[model samples]
Target: MRSRRAPLLIAAVVAALLTPAAAAAAAPAPAAQAVVASCSAAAWSGSAVYVGGNQVTHGGAAWRAKWWTQGETPGTTGPWGVWERTGTCDGGEPPIDPPGTEDFPVSQAQFNQFFPHRNSFYTYSGLVDALSAYPGFANSGSETIQKREAAAFLANVSHETGGLVHVVEQNTANYPHYCDTSQPYGCPAGHDQYYGKGPIQLSWNYNYKAAGDALGIDLLNNPRLVQTDSAIAWKTGLWYWNTQNGPGTMTAHAAIVNDRGFGETIRSINGSIECNGGNPAQVQSRIDTYLRFTSALGVDPGGNLRC
Candidate 1:
């Protein structure tokens, strides 16, 4: 008989096995309002607006209409959207280049050697497409930036959902239960109550409601929409990347750099076994994945890889 178990994704393995507790514990105590808007989406486009008790300033002169908004307050579930861009503005000041791009150059082969299975779910072209859209995510222009972001994503995803294909499949299977429970967007009646599907494994009724609202879908009642529709899953990932807490709140990169190191960032966003699940080998595996992924991007292993 065919196996009934659903496949895993990068998010599931990371969420299930990595340890983020120590880093989370050591993180600087959150301010009364732990969620502060860093750069206003308005700042990106030069248009200004006041939303949610904050002044949003667009950054780019050419992309003046661009701005960011939180779906909800800190510790709340919601999705973020980039409504428009009137003109272009530099998102932020560019970072100084790190030393030694010459000594440690990354290659596609290296990436495959480490994450041999990435191609199963995300095509090389697809990964490149994702990266090109958000060059500033890890820092623009630098190959190291791409590598770090890719590595971090891969490591965390592997740890989160077991593997890329698995995540997609499992997400498809458990679509209805996502975000329908004690958690704001959760369904307690479902298989896992919080087994919402997709790249970030979006769970909780509030989260589904917000995602549905942002994407203009009614996910609360039809959680399976994410699985049946690949576009929905991709949109959900982008939403998670942009929204979650808020713009510039606590990025996967920043979280990694805080308590332990870059590796820890992978664990935090991906969720750690030790911290979230209580497993050491899983944590070590995450570290190993990080190292291998970095090598592919041609970055030296010990460089100051920060967000």
Candidate 2:
């Protein structure tokens, strides 16, 4: 699963990074060999997710993780933290939103109507607060298209979260596998930390990294922020809706905005895992929610309801 990211204290930082990282790119270094530093393991990155048995070189020392970890500085997370002090690193490198607020089609009252029994963690204010991360979301097309997009997004979220009742993934057994060790950064936060959280149930270390990078949040290290911070949680949902295409060829936003139909949005979210007769019941569940949401928004469900 993927949850991209949000507006929090991030509005200012997100605004600042709207352009290129010119200054960072132009930084000077010592002449060739003098500037080179070699390490046996990769230098720790705050954005990376690391798991048990992974090693990293930091502050001239080598450290091994006792379990999945992230953002825990090699020397910092305390002796009992996930990282264990290994002798010394052979070598390693170490180191290193918001568009605007505007009126949204779905009112707070209506949102409540959508999920009256929803968990308090999924706050209406949080969703409204996260609007700056992707202003175009539910605002890029005609009134009908806008409503459809809103409904589609909320519908999927409702389904994923069981009407927003669950804040994190229920099946803990599958948690450890979300990490992709082959990725250079690995899962810095323990592999289990990335399991589905927030409204979109953001999962996977890479998705946290990508989403955090986009929103200027260090999600890879603080993945729990999704469950604890309502605005961040909503932003992750928007991040997936507006940007990630997932298993489908186009983004869910594109699916609705480009007249591609609601079915394509489903394809983009979990098509490879749940579509095309993969599980007809699940597809129908999503479709049923979509239809209900569209009706609430006073919009046509549109064609192509199946993926």
Candidate 3:
């Protein structure tokens, strides 16, 4: 039996988009390579067909096409897949945006533009404060790459929260069901405390525990902090964005920095649910939002916009 993909996103994100990684065992884990390649190399494209010996960069690594192929994602593609692991390439380090806002790549005005109707709970200051936790959030690669990533992230955030209008999940009926009594730690904060909350709507006791542990916040017993503190809420969102592999082999951060395109970000967030014809409407919605955000930021949306 296949293991369920780590539902590493907000309640709304998981429920609506993410699903199991039924083929997790198929690919071997990709390791970072020592022979660094040029950061300026063109990244692999899902839409373009490749023949033997063609090369591209993806997920911080260099890859060479073993034979003719198309649409096979790197890193996650198995050893038998058309592409072979070459070596690690320079993905880039944190670079400040043109906005000159300390560390966050998105300017306050840009964020406000993206979510003008956003709840007061989703403060710009709160998000900026959370940037320290993951310097790589939108800080990797070229300025255009950085802004594109920022747009991709916020686009999904907008979709999950309904343009940042809803801070919590609309369905309170699913609240108590997120707890897993089998977890040795159980639900110290009561069975219903782990309901969806914050910008992306976190839920489930295990997820709260995992996010809390990573951020050094005791959320297992005080899951409501995600609902009360805007900074902490944004931290959870960043933690998932930077660290969790979600339904894919790489994190969303890796997807953008490595030039795997925005569609890989969608796959990382939602498994195959909204991709591969599972839900074209949802995929189109995300792409539309991403395009809007990228346009607002004055950057090209790049290739492979769909999953």
Model 3 over residues 1-307: C-alpha lDDT tens digits? 7757664666566455534563455457898654334445588776688997788877677777778887665554458877677666665322223333655557664665567567889987788888888887788889888998899989988888998888888998998899999999999989988998887678889999999999999999999999889999999998888888887778888888888889988888886688789999998899999998898778998998887
Report how far residue 87 has shifted in candidate 2, in Å. 70
lDDT of 1 by residue, 1-307 (tens): 8867656786587567656885476578757643334453433211233244443332222221124443211111112334322223345422122332222233333333444344244433334334433334444335555456556666656555554545444545565544434555346345443354666666667776787787677877777776556556656655555445332245564443232345445434444335344665666776777776666465655443332
Against the true structure, candidate 2 has what lDDT?
A: 0.82
Cα deviation at 173, candidate 2, in Å, is 0.6
Q: After superposition on all CA atoms, what RMSD does each candidate show versus the true structure?
A: 27.5, 23.7, 24.9
Off by over 4 Å in 3: 1-100
Error of 1 at 164 (Å): 1.4
Distance (Å) between predicted and true CA of 156, model 3?
0.5
How accurate locally is residue 129 in candidate 3, as Cα lDDT from 0 to 100? 82
Model 3, CA-based lDDT? 0.80
Count clashing pairs, candidate 1: 73
TM-score for candidate 1, residues paired by index: 0.46
Model 2 scores worst on lDDT over the 10 consecutive residues at 92-101
The segments of candidate 1 whose C-alpha lies over 4 angstroms from its true place after superposition are 1-135, 138-142, 168-196, 212-218, 245-249, 256-260, 270-273, 302-307
